[model samples]
Target chain A: MSDLSPAALSPGGTIGILGGGQLGRMIALAAGPLGLDCHVFCPDPDSPAFRVAARHTVAEYTDTEALKAFAESVDVVTYEFENVPAETLELIAPHAPIRPGAKSLAVSQDRLSERRFLAEIGVPTAAHARVDGEDDIVAGLETTGAPAILKTRRFGYDGKGQTTVRDASDAERAFAAIGGQPAILEERIDFRIECSVVVARSEDGQAVVYDIAENRHENHILKISRVPADIEPRTAQEAAEIGIKTADALGHVGVVAVELFVVGSGDDERLIANEIAPRVHNSGHWTQDGTAASQFENHVRAVAGWPLVAPHRHFDVEMENLIGHDVDRWPDLVAEAGAHLHLYGKRDVRPGRKMGHVNRVRPRER
Target chain B: MSDLSPAALSPGGTIGILGGGQLGRMIALAAGPLGLDCHVFCPDPDSPAFRVAARHTVAEYTDTEALKAFAESVDVVTYEFENVPAETLELIAPHAPIRPGAKSLAVSQDRLSERRFLAEIGVPTAAHARVDGEDDIVAGLETTGAPAILKTRRFGYDGKGQTTVRDASDAERAFAAIGGQPAILEERIDFRIECSVVVARSEDGQAVVYDIAENRHENHILKISRVPADIEPRTAQEAAEIGIKTADALGHVGVVAVELFVVGSGDDERLIANEIAPRVHNSGHWTQDGTAASQFENHVRAVAGWPLVAPHRHFDVEMENLIGHDVDRWPDLVAEAGAHLHLYGKRDVRPGRKMGHVNRVRPRER
Candidate 1:
């Protein structure tokens, strides 16, 4: 049964995904056509990814026995989100090769570490300082200025675990708002637009970067991502460079996304790195309908040690996330011509939960 | 969790599939993005569809208990192939609403009934006659004449269960070749090209037809299928009409593929209905990359009782099947820039077995 074939066919193995969310579901869906089966290991029994994956084990990330059994059964492991506990990964690491490795997770999982890593890579970021104690908060505010954002360094996402520090005096209250966790104070840049560069990196260091997607947020959750970002050509190129450089620095295999804030206009337009998602990010979801290949497919390719495709974008697209009750508009979306709808199969209608996305495309203007 | 939603969001339920091949797998893959779960039922323990489907029952079609249990579990039922037995459909019909119906299966499962159905719909078909025994062979041969093909009325696909009769003397020999099963003798129509019109029809009777795809075969098995078939515009329009008419007449609630044989040149060109695949056909695989919504997606749409999209072809596509060892060239196929490859996770490389397909796309010429 073991056919010693090359990476072209993806070796027909099972990809064990750590998180079974929409990202994991999309990845499994892409992996299927490539002859790779996915075994989704998520604690959530109602996880949408479990439907599409070949197999699944419902156990907490901290369950060593379950993690070891799952890791041993698959060829390689990849994740949909970065908050996969360090101990869980450590338990599985010796049994299976985890792509975009532990270091990428360690860095992205913590804001302070992520910011430090960005600085080491020479990527420009918002002015920031770490805050552990009350004195540190005052000291960080002195550097970042009042009205900076106070964010918990760990487990912050979708604008959660963060609050605005109105002033040095208000920093303590903002810190307590995030449960007084270890945090960072960062000077928030006033940017023209938010955009993301999603790049897939192979284990061999080869990379392919997707066009930057200009994003819009509602309640700190991504609402819309449009490609052919409204940015000067140089900024897009620089953003792509940042994505590639960051992935290469982390020895990243699979898709890594860098969210950038376009801070200026015309020649003065420069990008400030905001965050790095160590997996396929929402902004790159546009690629699923805009290009010949998607970030999910590229992630599967990189994770399988296969060749990554340089996909050509065939259309200018606008991808709108179907948050909560927004999925109920699916009928109108499905009926609309040129609208590509993707529902994540999440049955719940939690107010901020991502239910799906619809990508509306128009012919690219040459 | 049971949120009552419109057809637009797909309502998130399990789609019971009656077969577990690449087609079923692709259907499940498409259904996932629409938030529909698939429960594939196949006797093959190593079925490719099992990997993507939410749940699977590896029990034979003759297993009535399993069929009942499977059918009762899903909201609706559909199949990948036409060979799903009459008794199996009868068993499932009571438990779930079957898309493309038992009647479509009955007609397609038998070549004679299929010919009659086409005739009743005012569609052109090659001259054919039924042969149940030796006496009927000579009589049917007399009507169809020399140089005809003897096909068993049931269980025939991929060039199986049929043989060509050279002349009157060869009629009995050809009949014997097919193991003397109840058969239909079809007059060999000299064809300029072989093409297919893949159409999806909703439960409400709305239909959308794809552009005719010209197919090339090797050893009676499909080798290549290219869109924008080498036919006149009027012929393509007529082929699409045939597809719509056939699907509507069969009361189809999913994709139905109508194979056509084009005869003669220019103004004199005409089509003869060759075969009807009452499911997502292999020839329609190009839609995965050539159009926004695929045949599988359309099938998913129809079966879910949702509104189907009128998909516009975005590229000129050429689809080549990866049969058996041809899949071993995955490296080159994966590396090919314009090529979109799909590999069914069938571990063995059996000769003539469809391993996967690749659709190469280029900018559509105006």
Candidate 2:
């Protein structure tokens, strides 16, 4: 086993966070209460996380001088997004320890590598084939068949850099739609629902999984997430096991969210791994109000090398995303009795942008 | 009704906070999720709240130019502490609305006035007499008797500015101990325990109170607060009712905590109002982890003129303050299961200084 006794961060230590989006803002907020300070590093001058952090550096991710200065200032390094460049990590790795590690980042950064890694760990995934050129797309189509998804291997999110193929004729068009990047064609699963398990693993390989979250998507963007997904206890247990196994396989020392597609009905229900997020996920936002400890706090704890607490749902919760114009309803939502609103301090509300979320929780039945 | 239709602040509006201590830091944190931005105003350059606020003004409270600029930058003004100078409020009152109002601040700032106001509203309090000189102190002792507590009428907190008089001859020594400031001599009550009710009131006079909290103090400083105070149902209800009444009486527009002393036994148990804090109290920190909505959020809602939510406790929570050296235990505390730690980003841990707090929550008994 890897050395379990990693150097734990002291209470007054500074945590270096990359990517100052909503996730980073929330993480910085969580770290404050634990006596840990945060230094947010993001390219955007108006990044939301900068408002809540003790210190921040605005520079390109690949700026070696800035990266080295930031790494030297903090006791440990963590990221809110998995898309951080490999070179950036390389430059800072020697200066500070990065939780969830470079390995987890490498796997999640590319669709092809993520699938291959999952398969190697014996985690069942959608039928997928790597696509490199026109010939590879044709061969990939022959293997995965029609009604498959063609997604760029890297830098794709919220349905960007992806397209659906219906037949052989659509293969070339799909490849062109994804900017002709190195890609993976995945067979679309006939599933009943989408769910995710967010787990946190400590340096010692100890892991704790939160309740499964049922997710709903609109235009390929997450719209809502409900906790205690309407699945059998056995299925839920299996999903948790998968999350823990994946986290262990990665040797990740922070939160990892494993999204899965649930197929079939009742006794035949099973989960197919879809993707892994190497940081806090939107689907786990309900934990902020419905559980004793939040996913953000757990992620902070893991990176700080503290023991993990398996948070249990104290309430049945529904978390609805306020995407773009959806945030205009903040007035009414704030007046709602059980609605807990959380808005990221973003200046503009472009279409499909994630502005905030509201969690409504009810006491769970005994 | 004093025009109950004051303009309510909309989301994205700026909130000007007068203190930049831990309380202000927490308030700023709570405001962020509600789509509101904070501009902390404090003289301390190292104020903890400055780290989280979107904007801040580091100038003396008496600086009219700075106060006016701060007032003009925000839609509403509020304070985390009651000690904000009257001149400072007057300078900013025309520029922005101040929640909890000047009346609440005027009363709570003086021990003599607070007691008189409570009596005016028919809220029972310890027998008290104002003392402006040695002659008044002698007369006050005659009326309140020995074992009375002599406290300054202004700026007293956490046991400072007060002394216990053991006998009539000890009055002069006790009075001198408190800097001979204008003070009040209060008859100390023989009580079983101390409890507090934290309530939030909106501009429209709508109010909501959280569950009562039982408090324990050391060296006159609050050390622990446990929710669902071990009291009779009727007593708890009565305490809550008194809190609402006090809030209404002061025309308070935000969170107000009324600390009470419990006397008698069983069915005969009753509470005597001891003090009224016009801002968030230390006792309500448990709500951060144990309730659907925290006191900080509710206070923000009230000051922002949003609808109030009467939060119910989901867990039995015990909040312990980390004073001075107590914060050194953070390494162990963060590893403890069910313990949620919150540290104010304060750099110094001077003796008796409030550095942070830990909330330990468990499933509440049905």
TM-scores for every candidate against the unseen true structure = 0.97, 0.96
Docking class of 2: medium
List-wise, what DockQ does each model earn? 0.55, 0.49
Candidate 1 residues B143-239, lDDT tens each? Answer: 7878788899999988999888887777678878999899998888999999999999988888998878999999889999998899999999999
Per-residue alpha-carbon lDDT of candidate 1 for residues A1-366, written as tens digits (9 for 90 to 100): 222235422647889898899999999999988999899999999999998988999999999899999999998889999998889889998998899798899999999999999999999999999888767778887788778898899988899998888887886688789898899889978999999999999888889999999999999999999989999999999999999999999999999999999998899999999999999999999899989799999999999888788967889999999998998787777778888889998888999999999999999973
lDDT of candidate 2 over A255-362, digit per residue (tens): 999999999869999999999999999999999888768899899989988777779778889999999999888778887878889999888988899999999988
Considering every candidate listed, which one attains the maximal DockQ? Answer: 1
Task: List the global CA lDDT of all models.
Answer: 0.90, 0.89
Model 1 Cα shift for residue B121 (angstroms): 1.8
Provide the global lDDT of candidate 2 against the true structure. 0.89
TM-score of candidate 2 relative to the true fold: 0.96
The lDDT of model 1 is 0.90
